[model samples]
Every structure is written in structure tokens, then in C-alpha cells.
Target: MTVSTATGPLRPRVRFTGLARLSPRAGVVASASLIFILVMSLVLPAVTGYGPDQFVDLPYQAPSLAHPFGTDGFGRDVMVRTFAASRVDYLIPLLIVAISVIIGCVVGVAVTLIGGFAEWIMMRVTDAIIAFPFLILILALVVVFGQTVNVPFLPNGTIPIIVAVVLTGWAYYARLARSQTLSLREMDYITAARIMGYSTARIVFRHITPKVLGASVSYAIGDLIVVMGLIASLSLFGAGIAPPTAEWGQMMFEGRSVLDQYWWVTVFPLLFIIVSAVSLAAIAERLVARLEGRTQ
Candidate 1:
């Protein structure tokens, strides 16, 4: 199905009710915010009146027309790095959340299809994983892998964060899918399809999974922002993307000592992170509202 929105031209309706229509506003704002950041980040390498790492002004320059966000402790342009680091900072969380969601869908399907004692066992194991404080579990994983382990799939250090996120975050998706599947399996359409001799796999995969996907996807919108914030928090604590990288959390960490002196260094990056999070959260809220038929 397709859906239309209040902004721009009409688009296809996605069948979410009520408040889901508001998702367009959220989506547009989020997209605009990210795009603005991305454009700045991507162009930083090319269009530098001042380099992110190069000292251009006196230390702790206040915001001005020339240096809109002011200068940092090292006199590096705060605005430049904030824009430049946008891609690197956002990229990790985006990747982590995508990987986690994919893993969630796979695990969710498996848990539901297996049912019986197997389901119980799998869920308990998942519950254990879920019960861990997210920060503590992440810290433990970092210790096991060491602070800077290279990923087998990616040459960079990003793989570890992705792995950590997927491993820790799937339980919720699994439970959601399993619960939905349990109820769906007993529905008349599924029963009729089964009676007509559809293979168990076909009924489960084709009939049940598709219906649940809409709800799962809507849920995932919320989860994405949560994942972003979690990753940023980890970064602030020193387990996320490392230094010399333009990640918002790391930027905040780098600026702490000089914050009283170079407040803009910390403030701009933190502001970007907050804006991005709020935008995504808005989108998720709209999606939930629409799905629940409360969009009006």
C-alpha cells in the first residue's frame, strides 16, 4: 500500500491511520536536518576557508560572521568540524541501527516459527541479553574486543559497534514478532490457508511475516533514534567511535576540558546530535500514532 502526506505533493498511502499522516512532517524535517548536516560534512574537505584541524584564529574565538560557530581550543574552526564530522558521527549509528533491525527481523521470525519449548528457551536467552544495562553490556563487549578491534567485514573499527548493537537490541524485536506471530497463526486467514494445504513455511513466511512487517517497521523508526542516542552515549564514555573522528559524542569529549573556554566547540556538535535525535523521534511518534489509528 501507499500513503500521502501533508507536505509536498501527494505520495502513496502506506495504510497507517490517523497520526501517521503526520509522519510526513517528521520525515521532511528529519531529512532536511540530515541533508543540511551531510552537505556541510561532505563539502568540508573541498571548500575549506579554514581546515577543521588547522588553527586559523586566536584561541576561543567567539561566534562571529567569519566564524559563525567560533573557534575551538586548538583554534580549529568549530563550525567546520561540526559540519565535517556529521557524516562520520551519524554514519556509525545509522549502520548499527540498520544491522540491528535486520537481525531483529530474522530472530523475530525464527522465534515465532519455532514456538513450543524452543521458543521459550530462545526468549529466555534473549531476555538475559536484554536485561543487561545497555551501557554495561557495551562496556563488557568493548573490553572483550579491546577498544579498537578491526571488523572482519569492514577494515575500519565500526564493525564492533554494529555487532554490539545487533547482539544487544534484537530481543525486543524478537518478542514483538513472536507475540504477533503467535496470534496471527491462529487467525482465520492463516487457518484457512493451512487447511488448503499451504506449506507451513509458506504460511508463516508469506502470510504471517508480511502483515507483521508494517508494525515492525513502524516500531523500528523509534528504535533507530534509541540506537543513535545509545551509540552517542557510548562514544561520550570512550567506547564508541574514537578521536580524530568528527562524531558528536567524541567532539563533546574533546571539548570538555576547554568547554568553559571554547563553549561553541562543544555546543554546536551537541546541538546537531540533539536536533537529529529529536527529528527522528518525531518521525517515530508520527508513525506510531498513524499505526494506532490516532493520526487525526
Candidate 2:
């Protein structure tokens, strides 16, 4: 029943009508910053002709036109490595969050649809997972799985970390999805679908899912940055992507020892993390507003 926009009705159970004009200029800045990071991380590494591990200059060289972010302890270009790290730092969380959302929405909707004993058991299980100290749980899981797990094309510890984060992260989305589904089920479209003899699957998928999904997406956008930080934090504990592979956390961990004399190594990587996270956050803020019809 709450599907209409301020102007008029859009679609039943669909909160989204169409794109809103983003009033905030911050969105453009955020988008540009994100684009720069993507280009630096994904494209220019090849153009620069420097491997992230390549010792291109004397170690600890200060920033220059040749080496804009200077060089680190191993003479690896700090600029290249920082951006290169984004490939892992950025992509991993996006992947983890995406998988979590899929699993969560399925579990959430399923539990509600099933009802009774099975639903009770699953919600209890989800609660248990969510109640635990998430970081410690992820660390322990990463360590346990990383020892035995390796996948082709994935960096070391990548698969294990993904497995660990997703294992814990999905519970959150499930709770969100379940709450959304509970409200949506009371809406007229769902009641009509039930009365019309539409298959349970059709009603749920066609009607409920589109509506429930928006909430999950809104919930998860901010989590992408959270998961990125988590992965970077893990690297500091010696459980990240391993040495020689440039990860922002790993770079920061290595640079901290010499940071008193060499600020570039630590500061540059940390700055990238900050800028990227801030950009993402800005985008998410406007996007959520855009979704909720709060924006002009």
C-alpha cells in the first residue's frame, strides 16, 4: 500500500520509481575520485611499466614527478603499490558483500515463507552468528581456512578471507531482508497474489523480491567500505594476501616500522584507503537518499 511516490503511484511493492536528480555536488567529486582510483589501480599500472614489486628507484626516495608517491623500503613505487592494492582491497569486499547479500536475501525470504520450527531454528542460528565478535571470528576463520585453502587466480588468503567474511556478513543482510519481507507480505499485492492462486514462488519472486531487495542493497552499500577495512586490518596481523603482493594493509604494516623517517609509505596507502572510503560513503549517502525519495 505504501508504494506511491509523492507525485503519483509508481508500482506496487516497488519503492524505486526512477532516478532522482542528485542535488549534492559531493556525488560528482566522489564519482571522480572513485574513477581515478579505478584507473590508477586497474589501468595505469600497465602504462607505468612498473610492477608493484619492481624496485624502480632507491628505497625511501621522496615523492617526485618520476615517482609521484616516492619509493618504499623495497624500492617499490609507493604510488603504484597503493593503487595496485586497490584491486584486491576494493574488489574483495565488493565480492564478499555481494555474496553475503545473495545468501542473506535467500535465507531471509525462505525462513519467512517456511515459518514455524524451521524458521525459528534458522533465525536463532543467524542471531548466534551475528552476536559473536565479528572481527575475532573472521580472523580465526581466516587463519584456520587460509592454512589449507588456495584457489587459482586468487591471491593467497583471498579465498579464506572471502569465506570467513561472507560466513559472518550474510547474517546481517538476512535480518534486514527478513524484516522487509515481513512488512511486504502484508501489502495488498502479495494478498492479491495469494487470492489469485499465483504460485508461492511467483508471488515471492515477482512481487516481494523487488521490494525487499532495495532495503538489502541500501543496508549493504556502506558495508562494502567496512569489509575493505576489515581485509586491510587483517593484513596487518599477518593473515592478509601475503608478502610481495601489494595490499594497502600489508603496505601500511610494513611501512609503520620506518614511518618515523619515511612517511610516504604509510601515509600514501592510508590516504588511498581514506579517500576511497570517503568517496564510496558519499556516493552511498546520496544513493540511499535517492532511493528513499528524500532528494530533489
Candidate 3:
């Protein structure tokens, strides 16, 4: 006679072991790196004795126990300036992303929901904006506006950059949201909501927007790294944040003159930029992977 088999709830088994765990491990490390950078940026100013523009050291001083990242050509501590620059380097992209996402999602959802002429006009406008070369358009706006508009809270010189970036950046999100909305609008749940006599606004907001937002958000994460680079490039070209601001691009520009002798001046800023971009990019990748259900 066969022994009676016992049937019970199955135990959960390990899904990832050894090499299979690398992706999650990398994601954790990337997240940790991002958090560390953000925390250091926020906390360093309070804890460190030297201010970003404080010139307590000799010009082009090499890295030392006293001045960790060395001094710039102006005799200012590189470490302090790097930390100070972190504020804008982080802030501008964040602001750009926020503004773009809001405007884009609203316009995209509205146009898609309304359809017909409104959608046509908005699509044409978006196409026109997209037709222009990205960097050139930003430069044109900055140059045309003369880069001196005084916004309430932002730095005096940053108004044009913000305006330009926001104007240019939002189109991408709008297009993305529209594409997602078009597809999501046809889903069974959306049709069911319509059949259930839900108002158009409720159906779009409650049902469609959330699904579209996920993809848009993933794109925004990747776009942050790009926006940061663009800001740095603008500063490098003398069109972004001005001097005395301790921005990474400006810092690198200042150090270019004596790069051979005083490598740390430029090197530190460059290193910081690279690290910031890489960390953001890694986080974006993980986010996209998780959104796509590829993450284990």
C-alpha cells in the first residue's frame, strides 16, 4: 500500500542565490550612493568649517589632511565649493523635472481626453518645440533673455536657464504621456469606467493618469542625469550659473587655465560631476527595471 501523502502550504524557496543576486545588490549599492551624496550635500555645509567661497588656503593647494579636496586657483577650499555646488546641481534638475512632469502630464492628458482639434494643435506645438535643437534652443533663450531676470527665490542669473530648461523639457514628457494615455485609454478598465457612467474627468484622472505617470516618471528619472549634464555644460560655456556660485561646471571652467599644474581644481569638480551623473543613471536604470518587472 502507498503511504498517504501530506498536502499542506508550501514553503517559500530562495529565488536568488550567488550570481543571480548581483542585480539587486547593484541596485542597493546605487541607491546607497545616491542617498550618501544627497545627505552629504545637505549636511556638509553645517558640519564643515570652511564655506564654499572661503579662501583659507593658498591657491592650487594639493589635497591634504586639512583641505581634503584641495584648493582652487582662487585659494578657496575645493571641498567646500564642491559641497556648495551640490545644492544647485541637485536643485535645478529637480525643479526642471517637477515642472516638466506637471505641465506635460496635464497637457498630455487634457489633449488626449479632448481629442480632435485641441489634440491636433497641441501635437503640432509639441512637434515645433521638438524640431528645434535642444542645446541651441536653450542657448538662444538664455542669450535672448540676457540671463538676468530676477525670479523670487532662485539665484539672479538662473532664471533664464530654468525657464529655458522647463520650456524645452516639458515637451518630452507631454509626448510620452500622450503616447501612454492613448494606449491606456483603450484598456478594458477605462471602457468599463465609461460604461459605469463615470465622468470623463474622473475616468481620465482616476483610471488613465496613474498608468501614464509610471512610465513618465521612469523617463523623468533618466532625464535628471541629462539635465544635470546640460546645466553643467551651460555653466561651462558661461551661460548658466555665474561665478561666486560654486557650480561644478563653473569650477571646472575656472580650473582649465592651470589644469596641468593644479589638476585638483578641475579634477575634483569633474569627479563630482561624473559621480553624480553615474549615481543618478544607476538609480534610473534600477527604477526602469523594476517598473518593467525585470528586477528579481
**Candidate number with greatest lDDT:** 2
Model 2: per-residue Cα lDDT over 132-216, one tens digit each: 6766766787767763466776677787788778888877767766777777788887788889999877876777767777765
The numbered model that scores best in TM-score is 2
lDDT of 3 by residue, 139-227 (tens): 77777877677667676468777787778667766777787788778889888887999887787677777777776665676677777
Off by over 4 Å in 1: 1-27, 49-59, 151-157, 196-200
Which residue pairs in candidate 1 have backbone atoms (N, alpha carbon, C) closer than 3 angstroms, thus clashing? 2-12, 2-13, 2-14, 3-12, 3-13, 3-14, 18-295, 19-294, 19-295, 20-290
Superposed Cα deviation of residue 90, candidate 3 (Å): 1.3
**Which is the winner by lDDT between candidate 2 and candidate 3?**
2
lDDT of 1 by residue, 1-296 (tens): 11112111122223333333555565667668878888887776577665666778887889998788988777778888888776766666667656655566556666566668877787777767666666676677777776566554332445556676777766666666676677777789878997898876687568876776676776666566666666667766668765555567777887888887778878898898778776666666667666788743
Decreasing lDDT order of the candidates:
2, 3, 1
The superposed Cα distance between candidate 2 and the true structure at residue 165, in angstroms, equals 1.1
Report the lDDT of model 1 for residue 138. Answer: 65
TM-scores for candidates 1 onward, in order: 0.80, 0.87, 0.86
Lowest summed lDDT window (length 10), candidate 2: 1-10
Candidate 3 local distance difference test against the native: 0.74
Q: Model 2, residue 131: what's the lDDT? A: 61
